[model samples]
Target: MTSIALIEAAAQRLAGPARRTPLLSSPFLDEIAGRRVLVKPECLQHTGSFKFRGGWSAVSALDPEVRARGVIAFSSGNHAQGVAAAAKGHGVPSVIIMPSDAPQLKIANTRALGAEVVLYDRANEDRDALGAKLAGERGLTLIKPFDEPQVIAGQGTTGLEIAEQAAEEGVSRADVLVCCGGGGLTSGIALALEAKAPGLRARPVEPEGFDDVARSLAAGLIQRNPRLSGSICDAIITPQPGDITFPIMQRLCGPGLAVSEEEALRAMALAFLRLKIVIEPGGAVALAAALFRPEAVEGDAVIAVASGGNVDAGMFCEALERFGG
Candidate 1:
């Protein structure tokens, strides 16, 4: 488990680089969920997601000499952008190994941020093996997206903010629904809440088919997703819960919730029409759970972390037309 002290240390390093994204609320959302809902719009974060915090934390924590050697990372999109932006900030080189089929916007943005982009076929190639090989050949540090302690601690900054911001809104106790991939964000936030606000419970929210975290929580063991490519929530869709992240989640989170693809799209559309914010499908899973899985949240107040907002224009338009106004 990532200690609160480590998370706080990461927070200190993140204050200069990461943006403290807003906690937003709307009367319409409240009515739909039938509870006072607070949203942490991490989509508005630097690099367009909460990954920036972890990226910066990992890069900045490196020894000065090691920082000069550069960093390597593997991500679908969000983490690519995060590591790219963070490496650029530190004046160090970064190499990102991403799937050839990853969202084009993310690939372009990673290049724009000055990272070398390596494309691999997700079905036939092993991203982990490729990343490690590249790191070894280039003498670069490999930054695992979710398994790293510093990365998890960096992500906990969001939980710290959620605890403080919720207090400001006269909310001391609320069910926190976090969009989860490999459980880094979920576990990080859960640990933060355990130390900062014990009254608030953290829950993992995942796409229906990729609900490995939910299953793992119920089974009391780490679980892998049966299939990784069927879901539209591409930003997530990891093969399994991370080894380091699973233990933290098991220790800190309650039973998880899973939402359908249609429900995620509906939540994305609702976020646009009601909250006036754009949220990616994977990022909207927590909001979808909060909106559609009412029984999962037992409190009067619910806080859903809208983790990212990086979608293609066509996808956004489709979500608007097919799901809501």
Candidate 2:
């Protein structure tokens, strides 16, 4: 199926559960950029991230027999909560393999949603192999975090909503800035935006250390990270883009941009103070890119997807201090 069809299917599948998050114009950012800046606050989404949209769509699309067998997933954080929460809603069992260094709050949240959590060391172990083994042993289907079509289509719903919301507000078209991890959200959003508003540009933003998507898009191939940079924006720190998402992103996304760790933290603080929204470091990268690279998006209305709000309290305080809050 096409990206539009997938988005429609995801909308239908997640109709009742997933929140239709609003796209509100940010007066503060607008003043700073001298153009209308809208914020798609998916941090307010169920499970504190947009991952629920894809997770629910994937599970709900399954045949009854498959659903009965349950599902398994591997995630560092947000995706785990999404899959777990969706599984709970569907009355299906779920097992999530997460990195041992994942945030405690995310791990707890996943378990609280009634999914079994398995921790693995990301540095030394192959999470995919472990997840597949667990899935085979338990007779469960493995739901990939970002590489699956269902997941991508589900994530595309954000773009659909952005387009609809922008039109509703009398804004014809706007540049969309989305944070990239494995390219699922960026690729999906780009497709949705292309369909919804052909003139609109979709840009993927990444942290300085995790610029695999940006680099790969420029080089016209998938590239691996030589070494993970210890950026505060951990959510978008994937080592590489997914096979399913890379080609789509190459076609749909404009030139990608990278922001520094300090800039990301400042943007996070700005979102909390000015926008009154709690955004994690990763989620704030898009806004940070806009702030640091204004010339690239100058004179165009922009929509930044603040993807999640699951930050450790200590990190939040540290971000505030770093940004002079």
Candidate 2 lDDT, tens digit per residue, 1-325?
Answer: 4479888878888788999998766677777777788889999999899999889989988898989889998876889889999989999999998889877877888899999999998789988889889888878988888999999999999988988888877777667889999988998888888888776778889988689998999999999887776678877788899999999989888888888888888988888777888889999899887766778884467778999888888888888888845
Q: Which candidate leads the pack in TM-score?
A: 1
For each candidate, what TM-score against the reference? 0.96, 0.95
Error of 2 at 268 (Å): 0.9
Q: Across residues 237-324, which tens digit of lDDT does each residue of candidate 1 receive?
A: 8989999999889988989999999999999999998898999999999999999888778889999999999888888889999978
Candidate 2 lDDT score relative to the true structure: 0.86
Task: Report lDDT per candidate.
Answer: 0.91, 0.86
What does the lDDT read for residue 231 in candidate 2?
Answer: 74
